[model samples]
Target: MAANIVFTRIDNRLVHGQVGVTWTKAVNANLLLVANDEAASDPLMQKLMSTTAESSGAGIRFFTLQHTIDIISKAADRQHIFIVVKTPQDCEKLIAGGVPIKTVNVGNMHFAQGKTEITKKVYVDADDKKALLDIAHKGVDIYIQDYPGEKKTTVDDALLSKVQ
Candidate 1:
């Protein structure tokens, strides 16, 4: 099992091969919080992800907003804690729901209509960018990186290109 969640990297792949095997080891995540509002309501989707994500070592947990907060707080002694969100708006919802957001670390948000044209890398909309800034203004460190080693993108950089 990953020792204690030190990281909460956002990967849409969720508990795929690379995520379970690679990202798990990298983050030392003991409890994996898959925090997708959509996935929470669907039992089949939850089952699939939960089953697929099962590792003999790491404990896989799927949480809706309420449960996620309970578990995260309950498991505070955990050296490393990870909470996952599928979209930036989802991130906003969690914060709005009072999850005590520490930061928003982005990964692999692709091109979409109304989104700010980030490099060839990712696309984010005004809603997403503003939500990010809101989190930042609240004093959370919003950092962006695609993988284990990439240049970190602050919310300012994300706002720079299109929002201006």
Candidate 2:
């Protein structure tokens, strides 16, 4: 990917087969920012995701949470970077480290054993929801939009906006 694709989204699944097959085309994205420390450390994980994406041409870069903070803070190029994270805590960490993202589009996060329902498509456990709310309060526009055209339920401002 080109490091310039412009979808600032997060999904625990990160860039999976669905992302490559669907969202890439839909959003016209060319750069993917995989923001996860573990993923950055694991070369195999990077290779696997790249393969899944077919590495057809899109630029995919995996970065530790801290590095991601620096990258976003300094760059505003044209490639359309899709910033991704596995959970709200990860997102929180990035921001606390000094990354200032303005919006976050949630792609997917499945319900684990004990998660609360914030919306039809959003589910957050107590601590995670708190973190998410904190991020929202900081002016990040958190939205749940699994696929293209899916109704985007806001993570802030919407009265019913609590990641369930």
Candidate 3:
């Protein structure tokens, strides 16, 4: 029994104010899952995420990518889920591992050493663009927007090529 995934977002900064409050309410999700390997293993980050969730009034969990793949189905049956992954590549891996990711929201991925800016908030390198293209090929809609009310920039082939 997989949990019903109401929303999926790719945000480097997981469990932030907007995600803790706005997106959780928008999706009507009770469970906020931070599915990132680094964050799940770090106690400091775990505490911070928990503290953020306390204010949002949403149940939150953290799991590494493999752990998420193992437990997501059963968890979904119990709670309406909202998942946030740290990168597009992670999201792609999750989808390949059997999570039914119908749509992916690219929120905030900070500028890295080898990455170029595609949008004001999104920066990607060749690998990132490739991962996003792969996800899109699997029939998942990948779009960018940090806030709920803002316009979503779809990551179509044209946009991906431009970035690459």
Worst 10 residues of 3 by lDDT: 71-80
**Candidate 1 TM-score, true structure as reference:** 0.78
Top model number, TM-score: 3
Sort by TM-score, top down from the best? 3, 2, 1
TM-score per model over all chains: 0.78, 0.82, 0.95
lDDT of 2 by residue, 1-164 (tens): 22343566667788787676577767777777788999999998898888866644567889998888767755556666667788888988977877656777776767777886665556667777778788889988877887888787777645334435
- lDDT for each residue of candidate 3 in 56-114, tens digit (9 for 90 to 100): 78899999999999888776476888999989899999999999789999999899898
User: What is the C-alpha RMSD, rounded to one decimal, of candidate 2?
Assistant: 3.3
lDDT of every model, 2 decimals: 0.65, 0.73, 0.89
Residue 30 displacement (Å), model 2:
1.7
Instruction: Show the lowest summed lDDT stretch of 10 residues, model 1.
Output: 1-10
lDDT of 3: 0.89
What is the model-wide C-alpha lDDT for candidate 1?
0.65
Better-scoring candidate (lDDT), 2 or 3:
3
Model 1, span 1-164: residue lDDT tens: 32243665555555566556566666776656788767778788777766655752566777776666555545656545566777766677776766666666777677766766664565777776776677777787777776656688776643544753
